[model samples]
Target: ALIAAFEARIRAQPVHVAAEVQLAATAAALPPLSAPVDEEAEAPAEEAIAPRAPQEQVRVRADLLDNLVNHAGEVAIYRARLEQQLGAFRAAMAELDRTNARLRDQLRRLDLETEAQIVARYQREQDSADPTFDPLELDRFSTLQQLSRALNESAADLTGLQGVLDDLARQYDVLLQQQSRVSSDLQDGLMSARMVPFDSVVPRLRRVVRQAGHDTGKQVQLRLDGTHGELDRNVLDRMVAPIEHMLRNSVAHGLETPAERVAAGKSEEGTITIALRHEGSEIVLQVSDDGRGLDRDAIRRRAEQRGLLKPGAVLTDTELDSLIFEAGFSTSEQVSQLAGRGVGMDVVRNEVRQLGGTVEIHSVVGRGVTFTLRLPQTLAVTQAVFVQIGETTYAVPVASVSGIGRISRERFESGTGGYRYAGEEYALHDLGLLVGQGPAKAEGQAQVPLLLVRAGDLRAAVAIDQVVGNREIVVKPVGMQIASVPGIYGATITGDGRVVVILDVAPLVRRHLAQRPAAEAEAQQQRHVPLVMVVDDSLTMRKVTGRVLERHNFEVVTARDGIEALEKLEERVPDLMLLDIEMPRMDGYELATAMRADARFRGVPIVMITSRTGEKHRQRAFEIGVQRYLGKPYQELDLMRNVYDLLGIARARD
Candidate 1:
């Protein structure tokens, strides 16, 4: 057993030259007791065990210390450049301040000049009326008129100066825009320089996977896909332990033993696939295993044993899957090195949350289990959806924003009720009202800007005045005075010098729910509404279509892109489809073609709504079997008319 264990360890790790030489020497020095071994003609054991350098040693051309030094130098250079730019920006601001002061001085002089001219005119009229007026008084009035004329000339010059100043301000704004772009690029480049491939941690993860497989007496194969995908070095460093724990969980709990897998009609050797892919601005890392999958029954029973579930309370599959992340929660019967401690998963959840990432689990019993970790490329900067509520600007992490759309008040069955989004019912909160800025919507306003936010299992819509746009923002913590605010997560400075609040999603939703208990009941009643799937990447477009559909009494499900649309389709096919011509990943033509190929979706009516109005584009869409082609900025009535025609429903005229 000792010899076998030693051999296994040697096979697992690359042998060093010194160790190989020592092992050979020790083996050669041993006495040969068998006649067959003595008769064998061979070179000395030391020579036979040729000392070859490990593959990793051969592959490493430069020392890691040298690489670190080089990267540090690059970072220092970027810092210097950033500092210089900031100094320039300050100088420009000072110049602008001086120009403003001069403009103010010019305006005051002009005002005084006008008043003096009026007084001189009145004096002249009085002097003309008086026949006995002194020459000195007449001369004084004439001097005052001359002074006013000079002041008028100065005012004209000031007006030209004002034009120049206005031009300068416009130029300054342009400069600022350029500077913003440059700074963003510089920051991105600096971040990219710090990005390391997902492969960086794969070797270590591979070892852990192997060891866990051995300990559990299961044959497991680890395969990595898209290992070249880059992630921030700091984020990757923090991810090492959590990823290892997840892989261990896959091998220990997710994958069954050889016998069990075979009995379940699966291959004798289980496979654990770790795939890394870039999804828009985020990186998606999926750890999946093919084994006897998550046992929902066992998880429920364990939850009951631990008193996590109340008596006679039933939990959905989604809720049951989430229970595994609870602190001190485990389904394993016996404690082991890999799991059953119930400490790892909760730690994983906490770390992910700290990094502004999300971890989701999808399991199909007897098929497999998949754990997906969606993380931003870097935590220092995050893409956020900027919105306006009353006069305040707030930003929400893009990951939390499921969709954006306009919600018309006229669409609600009552004055205020719940709405359905993405085939799920969620309470809608008026952001302006919640923040005490004003009413949710201004009186007599036709539509409200709505943002769909999903945090964990909770989904809700927030009403804002408008969505300024989406951009990458560096978040800073609010001071202690307002840090305790329930829904305020840090704050960030916008390019135009506005300090925008970043919302803490989960808490904000909780606060909204607490304030309006009636919304919960309304949400329960929204399940029976007709669902419409709105697929478009633009936030404005999503809201526009959603609002139009809602106005006609249809609930809407929205997707940012065609890929997400397909995922939503897997969950629930909508009563009607509204697709855009151009989108990321998959466009309308491609989506339509793909859907037409699938028997399940062949009969679904697709209305191609897009800005691409070229005849060729329309012809191509028609060829792809789109039922309708609506041009950009279609009127509400026209859009509804087309939708009703396709869905065979009549729209009531106001």
Candidate 2:
């Protein structure tokens, strides 16, 4: 109406003023409404203009959503087929075992009954001389003879029936086992088919993290690794919204503004690292930030004031951390609806957990915070370690291995004081005390084996009595139970018919050390010795020795020629030496003789590292006696272990 009124007035006005307004309006037209607009948006229009049309809802065909629903249901088909085949096959085998046992018992009973009848007849025949005195004796002997014949025939008939039943039982057992195997394989193939790469869900979201920071005037850096890991296709597609919410929370709430971050000695562009890895039965995803961690004490105060927590409540970090997931936990009213309504994370956690996964929280007071998520692989044969817990058997995967060792009570120490090993120190946690199930009765002192595992770049040594070899077992998920266990990924049955609980190293290791003292969090280098430098002219010799030393945890450094060898020797001195024969710049004998003559390297151990198809090298090496002698490509473990033992680093840690 205003534009029409102005046009009527302009026609009556001077021509020059009307021409300028007309030209300006033609250039400006309708305004764009993407970001915030300045004076340009509300300025007087130079020409007649129209507003933007409203966006359409884009109606999708019913069949598209139907197809999505159908695809989701397809996953259950494989699961149903697997469950049915396994269940039926197991039932059939059980029936076979029972039938075989029943048949065998029946045959044994028939045999005993036949034997008793025979014995009675024999006794009657032996006493027949006295029976001749009476006519009744002859009649009794005839009756006994008839009973013995009947018993023998009955026993033979039962034996024939038992043989037939046994054959049928064996066939059923074999058929059931085959069906179980085929079903497991089909289920695995189906699962893998449903997996979609994780990046697909978050590709556009990566840019959102940056844009969120820009809008809020906060600087942030996004780091993503292992984006190649996969999740269910539909689940992956729906994941963008939840993850985007988290990213918003991170920029607006978790990360400090640029000025604040800079004052705290952090980079202006705060770092957020996202990682994904497959652990046993599941895919472990982590999103962490080098920003302000969770404020536990603050959270506690709020909870108490709001009556969410009772006064003087004693709660663990794990329990306190869960308060963030409570419904309506959001405290920031002026904030955008992106996150922190306490509702967003709850939805995310529920959606993931419903898919057979769990979420956890870990933070450092000064450094940063991490959110850990565990999602089952769903489509592949997961590696698992099978062990017996109570009456049931379970498996745990080998990827969780820290290292294996043995510790007796004499070697065990309390968790407080630091223990020394290999001229270094380490804090210890007695495995028996931690598990609460050491042994009913241990013989030959209280000794136990240990396994050292890594969690988020941190290491912990755990103790166990036995080490089962690695296996690829089909993961069977248990509902509700997975939520309660911090480290469990899934369960699997072993080839030996034992059930094993697969342990996820990330959570298991973290939980193991979660309650312990801060000293236990020290670097693993204290338990590990320094790297050793080995120099040899032969390529085979260098690789062979390096592997041996490395297996024992002595970081091995090697060189192939004398020029490179000498340079390394000059830069660093090794714990021990293996001088080789027939080299370019120097030979085995010459290097050894030179080492003994040099004052700086005189104390170093120099073993005769050679392969001379003869005893001459040995005789010459003995003359020096600087160290022991070893042949070329010698049994790797022996030589490296000997070096470890000599360096005082071979002893097991408690």
Candidate 3:
């Protein structure tokens, strides 16, 4: 009916009446709905179901529940064994009871036999004078001898009972031994189950390094070695942030541009190698790059600027390298997506330590840098040396403890006086005094427990009331309220169920060293504020640098280019010249050569601060007697440190 109505409406439209009439004829010739539909219903249900077929399910990975179920079954098996052991123990106890009853009966028989012998002896003494009593006495004595023979038999029986008890005791020991083995194996298997491959973190690291290179306009070729090494899953997860941060640091601060690499007699591509491997029970990860290495002098100067060290404080190369891990410390002048916020390295150190790890750095002046992170495979357990400080108990990581000993009161010194150990002197830090407990019992003629610990490049002996030996402890995090407490890392429960704080040896040593009295002010005082020549074609560069130097109490001279700088030099030789690489006429290279040729300015220091951070530029600058090559967009601290260091000008303030 609906089709006929539609046909009639189409015909009334009049635009295509002939077509509409033909469609109506076709509709009228088709089979009507009232016709039997049995044939259509006879079609297969399978065909009507749209050819449904089963499809395999896709999953990202296997479910953890499967492994858990297997372990649960194994645990059940161990539980059954434990029940069997309990039954065996009960049987052994029953046998032991039976043996005890037999031994008690044997003892009673021996006591009765002994009493009969005593009675016979008394009768013999009373009948000694009578002949007729002789026969009776003989009978009584014979009875006594029989009783003695029975007592001997009872003694033999008692020995047999003792052997039975001993056998039961051995069986009990074997049961306990078997149970212990099963428990240990289960624990080891569980720990192993928690491990994962080190390369699990590589996919994310690759993305981070690639993005960093693109952002920095540098070509960094990253190669991973021993990626299949396994680590605890939790340790690997926590390590992601630190490793990613280090990778970003290498790309942004370590690697050079393709053009720069070529100029430095290196390949156009910069190479970063991340190698992982097992070192005994520990996992060793090395991140190394072939690039301009760390500048120790720059680091020392920066440390002084941050007030981490006094001006002109002398430190070894290793000590200087370690300053980078200080909180809120960074060398970059500008903040970017990658760095310059001064937060990465400290986080790296703290996180690594939380996993019972250490970070060591090695670098050469112009070759490259390598950061080595050594961590235990798992954080589930660790060996610690427990010590008692005042009334509090503390656990120090065994890895960080160098030695333990006792020092006589006469040999021990307070503060920076240092203590002698094995013919060597190291800084001595009294734990009590360091923690604000005042001087310890120094007047008493008693020996003090000294714990020698290594904190980075410095070794020091910490005085404590007592050394509590070593223990394997399960580390647990401290409450949030005390998370910021200095020198304490975490807490763990002792065997006696007492909670003890774990001491972070590194922070303790750092804290003590920082408290040392500064050496007397530098002997050499500057006669006057040093004069500096700021040479740059960019007016803004000249002004900024000049103003920075002036603020640091430096007399400033300005020049627009190398030609103008030479003119200024002719008038007077400045103590230092901060020259730019590119200029309108007679660029820095040519001007540097001119200055080297001059007799008066030959000894004067020339520092090149420029946007051209290529090795070729630096090599040329060095050849022309540039004392330092500082990259542009430099930190004000870096600039000041370099100026003060090169000019031999001591900081006026202590």
Best by lDDT: 3
lDDT of 1 at 86: 60
For candidate 1, the lDDT comes to 0.75
Residue 466 miss distance in model 3 (angstroms)? 8.2
- Candidate 1 Cα outliers beyond 4 Å, as residue runs: 1-148, 170-182, 410-417, 430-439, 442-444, 477-489, 496-498, 510-654
For model 2, the local distance difference test gives 0.61
Higher TM-score: candidate 1 or 3? 1
TM-scores, all models, native as reference: 0.57, 0.41, 0.52
Residue-level lDDT of model 3, residues 1-654, one tens digit each, is 957686778867989887877877888888897887676666676477776678974342324633553454445345545656666666656645555565566667766776666666666676564555544355544565566667668767866866776687678667767876776576567667677788777888899989999999898889999988888877888998999999998888788788888888999888889999886557889999998888677677778889998997887777788899999888887998897899999999888876767888998866789999888766665678887754477898876666887777766753447766677566777776555544344222268778887644557788887777886566667887877877777887654446788887667567655764421121122134467899987767988998898787787989878888887776667888898887767888888888889797888888888999988878888887889999989998888888888988776653
lDDT of 1 by residue, 1-654 (tens): 434444555667655645755675676676654535532455566556886666662233324533543444344344445545565666555545544555566566865776666666656677456668633355554555566567657666766766676677667667666765675576656566667788778789989999998898999999988888888876798889999998999988888888888888888999999899988778888999987678888888888889988766887888888888889998888998988888899899777766667788888888889988878776666789988864578888887778887677775324477667778766777676566555454322467777887766667777776788997676565788887777676777654555788876666666665766554444445333457889986766887788878777787889867888888888667778999977768988888898999997888899888988999999988888998998987887788888888887756766
Better of 1 and 2 by TM-score: 1
For residue 590, give model 1's deviation from the true position in Å: 57
- Residue pairs clashing in model 1 are 405-543, 406-543
Give the per-residue lDDT of model 2 (tens digit) for 1-654: 445555666677766676757754764564533547666755645322655567875555545654543443344344444555566656555545544455555556765665566556656766655644543344544454565557657656766765676677567667656765775565555555566688775668778887888788887888989988887665565556667777777776688888888899888888888888977566787888888887788778867877889989999776787777666676454656454456677777766644445677888876878888766565235454443322333455554443455555555533344444334333454333233333211222245444554332334555444454555555556568564666556665444444456655445444556654432443222242455667676555677778767676666777654556566777666767666766656666766777778786778876666677477768877786546777766776567566766676645653
Stretches of candidate 2 off by over 4 Å are 1-144, 234-240, 296-301, 310-320, 339-342, 379-654
Return the TM-score for candidate 2, rounded to 2 decimals: 0.41
If both were scored by lDDT, which would come out higher, candidate 2 or candidate 3? 3
Going through the candidates in order, what is the number of backbone clashes in each?
A: 2, 16, 0
lDDT of 2 at 471: 53
Ordered list by TM-score, greatest first: 1, 3, 2
Better of 1 and 3 by lDDT: 3
